[model samples]
Target: MTERRMVAAIDTSLVATAAAAFSVLCASTSFAGVLADSRWVFPALLVVVVVAALGVLGRRLHWPLYATASTQVAGVLVVLSSQFAEHAVLGLLPGPAAISELGELLSGAADVVRTGVPPVPAEPALQALVCLGLGLVAIVVDLVVVGLRSPAVSGLLLLCVFAIPASLSDTMLPWWTFVAGGVGFAVLLASGGQHRRWRRHEDREQVTRALFGPTSTAVAGTAGVIALLTGVVFTGVGTEGRLPGSVPEQFGGTDGIGLQPFTSLRGQLNRDKEVELFRVRGLKEPTYLRALTLRKFDPERGWELEGLTQGVEANAQLPLPEGTDIGEGDAQRVEIQPIGYRDPWLPVFGVPRFLSGMGVNWRYDPASGIVFTQTNQESRPYVQQLVVPKPTPEQLRDARGPMRVAPEYLDTTGIPPQVTDLAQRLTADAGTEFDKAVALNRYFTDPSNGFRYDLQTAPAGGGDALSEFLFRGKRGFCEQYASSMAALLRAVGIPSRVAIGFTAGYRQGDERVITTEDAHAWVEAYFPGWGWQTFDPTPLSDGRSALPQYLNSELHPAQQPSSAPDPAQPSTPPTDGSTPGGGPQDDQGARPAPVDPRETEQSNPWPIAIGVLVLALALLAAPAVVREVRRRQRVRAISGGAAGSAGLAWQEVLDEFRDRGAQPAATDTARQVATKLLEHHALDESGAKAMRALVVAVEREWYSANGRSDESLPETLRTVLDSLRRASPLDLRSRAFPRSVLQLLRPQP
Candidate 1:
C-alpha cells in the first residue's frame, strides 16, 4: 500500500477504536439505573459501529474528509431517529417532531437527575436521551481524531463522555470499564502519531508538504498518559453526599434533593464532630422526636422515600396517628428551637394537636405525623401541643396483625430470603405478631448477641444489608438495628417501617439540648387497634438508657416519672438553660465518639496501585521519548548550513542501522556505510541510488570548503532510513530509538 493510504487506514482504525472505547465507558452509566439491564449499551455500540463502517467506505471511495464526516454524522442522526421511530418525522431522520421529542426526553431526564437518587429505574425517556447523547459523542470523536487529525483533543472529548456519568453518579464506575476506556484513548493517540508520520513522508514525495508540521508524538503521548490517569482517579473515588455531619444548606424541600432520607441517616452517623440540632423544654419525660418515616423498602435500594403528602398551610390541623385515641392520651405542651438541624419536617415528640410560631408554607403528613415546609425554613422557636399515648404491653398483645391492618402496611415483597429466614428463626417461639415483634426487638437489644453498635463499620451484604447485619457482622448503630427489626417484623406478617429523628438530649435542669450526635433511627410496628407503637431495638450503652418503660418488661426505677404532671400545666419548674454552642455540648462522660468511616484519609490501596502502574509505564517508554527529543535537538542544531545538516542526518541514519545490529564500525566513513547498505541489498535499486547520493552529499560537506548545498539531502537521507527500517528484522523501537547517542554520552574509562 502507498504510504498516504496506509496512514489514512491507521487513522481510521484509531478513530474506530476510540469510538468503541467511549461506548463502553458510556455503559458505566447503566449501573445508575435500578434495573440490571443497560439500555444504552446496544444503541451506543450501534452508533459507533455504523460510523466506523461509513468512514471506511468513504476512505475507499477517496471522498473528502469533510464529506466523510458529514456522512457519518447524518448516519448517526438517521439511526437515532429510526431507533425512536415514534418521535421521528419520516421514521428515518430527526425533524421538527423529533426535535420536540428530544426536548421532552431531556426535560424528563433533568427531573430524574434533580429529584431521584442513583440506580433509579431506567424510564423510556431517559433511555432515549442516553442513546442520543452517546451518538453525538461518537460523531464528535470521529471528527476530532480522523477528520481534524488532532487525536489529543479527541482524548478530551472521550473524557467528556466518561465524565458525564462519573460526575452524576453516587458511586464509582467499575474499574474494568475505566481500564478499557483508558486503553482505548492511549491506543488512539499512538496510532494517530504513526499515521501522521506516514502522511508526512507521502506529502514530501508529492512535493506538497505544508510549512506547519504535524503535532509532535510527544504531545499525543503526554495527553494519553494524563487521560488515563484522570480515568483512574475518577473510578477510584466515591461521590460525596449527606452523611451525619455533611448536611447541606438545603437539607430537604428543594426541587433538587441530592440525598435520600436513609443516606441522611448514614451522613449523621458518619459525622465526627457534634453540632446542636435543636433544643426542647417542658417535656415530662425523655422520648425520640419523630421527623420522617420511610415506608417503601427495596432489597437492592434499601429504604426509598416515595409518595410523600403535598404541603399544607401551617394552620391546617395534623392528622392523628393511626389506631391511636386522641381523647385518651395525656396532653403535653413543649417549645422547640432549631439550631443546625435543617429538614423540611419539624421535630415533634408525639402526635401534634396544634402548632404555633411557624410559616404558612409548612405542611403536615397526617398519616406519618411529619410536619414539613415547602421551602427550606430558618430555625425558629415553635410551640407544639402533643398527645402522648402510653400503650401497655397487654393492649399491644391483644392487637391484630396483617389481617386487620391496611394491605399497604403488610407489603414485604421487597424483603430478602435471608432476612425472612432470620426473622422466622428469631420469632418461632412467639405466639402472636405483637409477640414476634417483641422477640425481634429483644434479639437486637440483648447485650449477649455479640452485636456491637458502631458508626464506622460498613454495613455488610451486597444489597441485602439487613441480612448481612443480622447474620454476619452484627455491628451498626441505630439505623441498622431499626431497619433490620422493621424488615423482620414485616417478614412475620406484621406491618412496620423505620422512623428517623433525634434522641432526647441531655437534660440540664428542665431543658434538653439535641445535637447532630443525637440523630437516631428506630422501628414502629403497627397493630390492629393500638396504632404504630415505637420499638427501640438499639441497645443502650455509654450512659444511654435502654427502651422506654412501657416497651421493656423490667423498667429501671430512675426512668419512671416522679409524678403524673398535668398536661396543661408546667410539668416541672422551668430552668433557664442553653447548650454552650447553641447545640448539645459534647459530654465528657459520653462514650468516645466513633470515627467517620467515609473520611478520605482512611487507608485505600487504589491510588497506590494506579501510581505504580503509571510509574512502570513511564519507565518503559522513557528511552524512546528521550531518544526522540535528542534526535530533534541535534537536527535543529545542525540546520544553520544545509551541507552540515545533511551530513548530520546521514550520520544519524548510520547509527540507526548500527542499533538494528547491522553494526558499522565507529571509524566507518559515509562511503563505507553506503557500500555496506548496497552489499546487504537492504534497499531497492532506487533506494540504493538515493543512499549513494546521500554519501556523495556527506563527502562534499565533510571534505570540501565550499560543499555542495544539497537541499534534497535531508529527503534522500529520510528515504534511505525508511528503506533500512523496512529491511531490518529488529522491532521498531530497537531500530528507531537513538541508543547509540546514549553510548556516546556515557563517560568511558
Candidate 2:
C-alpha cells in the first residue's frame, strides 16, 4: 500500500476504535437503575477513556499486540490505584500496598453484590469495581476494533454491560440508555472502512478497481433496527411489580424483602417530584403507615427482614403480632386505596386484626408485621380493622421485661463500638429501658446535638457510613436517623427494629394523601409488656411529624390519648406549622432560635445562577464549535502541501454534504460524490468548475503512480463550500447543531 493509503487506513481504524469505546460507555449508563447515584459513571467513563488513549498511542508507536494490551491493563491499574488505593509507590504507580487495598475493596464489593438491593449506595468499593470492569471491557473493545479490524464483534462485548442490570434487577432499564447504545453501535459500523478489490484485463495496460465494494451498511442497519425494537420493548412491556429476592408464593411475605430496605426508602425520598402513593379514609388520627418491618440488622448492610416463615392467608382474620395479647390494644377501622405504589408489599396503619377485600394471592406474616402478595397491589384497595396499643410513660417505666421476643431483634453481633459507647453514655443515668429509649430519641431531635434533616448528606467516605453519620457527620435524612437510633437501642440491650413506610401525610379533602415525600423511616422498639412502640427520631421540619402521646411529656399523665384516632370523633386535617428553615418545631408551632449568626444569614444566588447560564450557552454552541475546529484542522492540513492534501480536500466537501443532511452511499466514487454535490446544490459555473478540478486532483492522488501535490486544491475546496453555503443558507438551528457533528447521535438514513 502507498503511504497515503496506509495513513487513511490507520485513521479509519482509530475512528472505529473510538466508536467501540463509546459503545461500552453508553452501555454502562444502564447501571443507573442498579446503583443509587451516577457516581460510578464518572469512574467508568474515566477508565474507558484512559484505555482507548493508551491503545491509540500504542498503535501509533507500532508496538506488538501483546505489548499494547498489557500497557492498557497497566494504565487501568494506575487509575484504580489513584482512585481507591490508599498508598502508592510514587502516587502514580500501583505498588504492593495499592494492590492490597484493591483486593480489600474487591472483597467488600463482593459482599455488596450478595446483599445489596437495587439502587444500592454507591460506595468506594462499588465505584472501584465499576472502574476495573469497564476498563477491561474497553481493552477488549479496542483490541477487537483496532487489532482485528472487526467492529461488529466488539458490540457483543458491549452487550454484557447492558444485559447485567436488566437480568439482575427486577426493574426495567431506562429506555434512553438503549437508544444511546444503538447509536454508538451504528457509529462503530459506519466508521469501519470498505475493502478494495482490483481486476486486470489481459488486453488493457492499466488495472481497474471494482465499481462497488462490500460495506458494513447491512450489518449496521440491522443493529440499528434491533436497538429500536429493544427500546420499544423496554417501554411497552410491563413487569410483574415484584422486587428482587421476594418471598415464595406459598408463604405470604417471607424473607424476599432482604437486606437494604433503606435503599428503596432513600431512593423514594430523593425523587425530584413528590408522587401520591396512597389515599386513606377514616384515619381517626395521624400515624405512620407500616409496609414491612425489618427485624435483622447488620452493621455493614443496615436493616433487613428476617428469614422465611409460614404465613396465613391475608383475606381472613389475622393474628396479632408476636407476644401481643388479644384485647390489649384499641380496635380501629380504616380503608386504604393504593394509588402509585406498585410494590408487592401492602401498607397498613397498624397491626391488622381483620382484613377484607384482599385476594388469595395476598398473605400475612403476623410475626414480622408484613402483608404481601404474589402480584402487584396497584389496583388493590383493602379495609383493615386494626388495633393500636396505647401505653403511658408511667406504665412503660413500671413494666418489667419478660424477654419473650425473637432473638433477632436483640442480636447485637455487628453493632459497632462507637454506637455502644454513645448509647451507654446517653442512657447511663436512666433507670429503665423506656427512659433510655426516651433519652436516645431526645438526643436525635435535640438541635444542640448537631443533627439536622438534609437529604444530601456528606459524600460517603471509607469505613462505616453509619458510624460517620453518628459521630463525624450528623446531618442526614430519615434513614440515617432511624438506622443510627435503632443500632444504638440494640447496643443498649433494648430490642429494636427499623420500620419502613410513610408518615401521616397532610389531609387533602376527606382522605389523607400520602406522597413519596412523606416516605419515612423510624425506630420501633419492642417492650415486653407494651409490645412495640413507635418512635421517630428524624427531625422532620414539617408539622405532620407528631410523637406518640406516651413520648410527649407535655400531656398530662391521665389525659394522654392513643396515637390512633378515636372511632367516635370526626376526622380532621392536621395543622401545617412548618418553619422558614427546616428546623424542628414544638407542638405549639414555635421554633428554636438560631444559635449562630451565620445560620441566620442567607447565601447569595448570583454566582450559581451565572455559572449555570454560562454552561447552558456553551452546551448550545458545542456542535458549531466542534465543527469549526475540525474544518480548521482539515484546512490547515490541506495548506501544508502534503501527499494526502487532495484526500483532505475531498473530506472537507463530504463534511459539507453531511452538514446539509445528504448521505451519499459508501460505494460512491470521488467523481460520483462531486456529481451528487453539484446536482444537489445547483452550484453556478464557477463552483462547478472548482468542484470538477478537485475531483480530478483526488482521483490523481489515489490512482496516479507519481502522485503530485495540488497547490490550488485548498482554494478550490473553499470556493465550492462558499457556493454551497450561498445556494442553501443554513438555518440557525442547522448551523448551531450541525448534522455533520450530530449524525452519530441518531440513526442514519
Residue 287 in model 1: shift from native, Å? 3.0
- Tens-digit per-residue lDDT, 65-170, candidate 2: 9999999999999988866776977765899989988998898776555434455556678889888988999999889877887767887888777765665455
| TM-score on alpha carbons, each prediction | 0.49, 0.67
Instruction: In model 2, state the lDDT of residue 327.
Output: 43
Looking at model 1, the pairs that clash are 32-119, 34-120, 243-267, 243-268, 244-267, 244-268, 276-583
| Over 4 Å off, model 2 | 1-10, 25-51, 70-135, 168-180, 193-221, 231-257, 326-330, 374-379, 398-401, 416-425, 428-431, 456-472, 554-749
* Best-matching candidate per TM-score: 2
Clashes of each: 7, 1
- Scored by Cα lDDT, where does model 1 land? 0.60
* Per-model CA lDDT versus the true structure: 0.60, 0.71
Cα deviation at 359, candidate 1, in Å, is 2.5
What is the overall TM-score of model 2 with all chains considered together? Answer: 0.67
**lDDT by residue for model 1 (46-85), tens:** 6666776677567657798788878888887776676554
